[model samples]
Target: MSEKKFQTVQLTLEQSVESRTKLIQGAINRAAHTAGVVSLAGKGVYVIDGLLMKSGVTLDVQAGVTLMGSGNEDKYHHRPGPFELLRNQTPICALIFGNQCDNCVISGKGTISGNYRCFIKANQEQAAHIESHHYPRPEMIYLQDSRNVTVEGLTIIDSPFWTIHLAGCQQVKLANLTINNEVRMPNTDGIDLDRCQYVVVQGCKISTGDDGICLKCTEETKRFGDCTDIEVTDCQIHSQSAAFKVGSSSFGNFLSVKVVRLLIVNSNRGLAFQLRDGGLARNFQFSDVKISTRDFSEEWWGNAEPIYITFVARDHETVIKPDDGIENVQFSNINANSPTGALIYSDVAGRIKNIRFVQTQLWITTEVGKMRHYDLRPSEKRQSLIMPVSGLVGRVKQNQQAGLSVMYRSNEDQPD
Candidate 1:
């Protein structure tokens, strides 16, 4: 795989990074530096090491570069410059600004702060001695296998791991980005677009601990199809989890997701499309969402339920056989104000068609319970929750011109 050669380099904030470090180490030693810019006016640590850290490398940082991280220079946080407080150090562990670089573009208006501990704490056993704490590794601004990339207007702050991680890329575009952590920080995932493809996340503003804006493609990396045509528009996803999510890692196949004009508020679980264990989601949509009610106590695993869609089969590494559930989903014109009345939950045995609540209006301050749809009854044996069949339960048996407005209710109350 060798036939890609194009480079550009530019570094501002008044040059002279110690007399241009051997002319920036000879235009990154023959790869010929296609594009590089780091406007220094700073507290230092612009130590981009190795064959200038291979893979094409096209970095652009103009408007005031303050790339310093290693934390703790007394307090008030943020410190550790001089290439991470050196003393015969070479800890430049794969800091390749842009890897597999195609049409790379890491825009100006800079800031890539790090110092370890956005959050990570492991070493369990809460029965006796064993215990540990550190948290905050959400400092991963990695854009892997890059393609037509564009990480615009950056202001990435105190990421101890996930500010922006676009793994296995293709035609990526994360616009007007601004990711931050410190809401009880632990594995702070602000913007994680893993196993990427034609992505477009616009006008971002994320608050994190987990799941601010996540669209993952996983099934243990066999690379199963469909992370298709994504579009997350006009964003502001403040999260604790599910400001927006699809698949807990759907053996791949998290298809055609579209979230338009969102302004998610105080999220614990606002607008979610989660596939319980397996994945085969299709043409998903969530439009015009706005939710608030940070905490009115009740969050037993949190159920503010603005609109939750779940499909559980479990096992991406083997054990999922109910035909790895979830298929063709739709949620339009969303509006929320829930106090919890089971807004939505699809347990999954298949066929979750056109799930709409058009021109939606929900302000159920408590008690609107039961809207479960689990399906699976063809002598395939047990798995039914009923109450969903606007159409396509046995291929259009009812909706019969909306007669009796369509009826079928039975979870075990029977009597019909």
Candidate 2:
């Protein structure tokens, strides 16, 4: 790795405790033009109201420098009226935001604390008011329309919402990040890549209440382009939801994606591909993945399945115009132990085709408890087609049938 010298500035907030937020933001603003490093030194607690990073700046929190959020909702700024029709429809005011910036980095062996629990009462009350407007929760880091970004070696804790959100970004790299949010904190996804391309996430340890590492393409993101050419490898993930997922918001294509060498433990679901919206999710590859899934409450999205791939309308009532379905996916060297087996379901109009599972060992531990079988059901009154599964090591256990369950529903056929 080549090293580049950076003009550095050290910030001390102990002297002016009352103006700590202003001092930090001003330092970052000054560093943007100089391509400099703003180092938060010493063991002082620097409470930041919010930070909007400029291009070509590096916020380096040195060891023992703790940047804590003020935890005051009034201090944060929300994006005005019009909101994007994506997951987390509520526009959140974030702790650190990078908007359409380039060549930025947030790195160092320090802590960025969200202090999320301090607003539990407020979050609960806001949630209770269902008819009211969407509440503005604060994410730890929200980078939108940015390029050439790198976030490395940060210990992020107690995030209020999606911990690291990358929207409409390109050529981003996230490595060696240790993100630990409270298990009870809802919607605290570890790393969310929304309509991001040419991204690489590796050597990260993420444990959160929601999905660990997820790729989403919403309607707003689709306007930019498809999310393509992403890679995630060598990560330890534990989540109440799926450890690694493509989408619950797939409005655009997810192409040329790859995930390898993942250790997923104690997650609700191991791997999931949810293509509800009209999109094409294809040319995906997953290899050398070891997964352990357990049952969680229904309030969560998954059911402890080792692998799940489904295609359905976004809503049952609304009609979803099916585009190119999920196709040309490959999973190899996957060893999973779960209460439920793999589920690959596709509707009649959109079929999941050419799915190959090579050297995959999925052991359903029914002795632990009564578990559900692999469900391959299409929509109502639709003929279900059986796509071939090659090199499947484990059997689908349902109705005492042990081996493979590759059967098609024929309109003219009745069992003899």
- Leading candidate by lDDT: 2
- Candidate 2 achieves a global lDDT of 0.74
Cα lDDT tens digits, model 1, 299-386, are 1124445555555443333245554544455555655554432223444433344454455555444323444332221112233444
Clashing pairs in 2: none
Every model's TM-score: 0.32, 0.83
lDDT: worst 10-residue window of model 2? 390-399
172-289, model 2: which lDDT tens digit per residue? 9999999998766677889999999999999999998888999998676655688899999999999988899887777788999999999998898898887666578889999999
Identify the leading candidate in terms of TM-score.
Answer: 2
Report how far residue 211 has shifted in candidate 1, in Å: 6.3
Candidate 1 residue spans exceeding 4 A from truth: 1-97, 100-142, 145-165, 169-189, 196-205, 208-213, 218-241, 247-265, 268-271, 274-307, 311-322, 326-338, 341-344, 347-416
lDDT of candidate model 1 versus the reference: 0.52
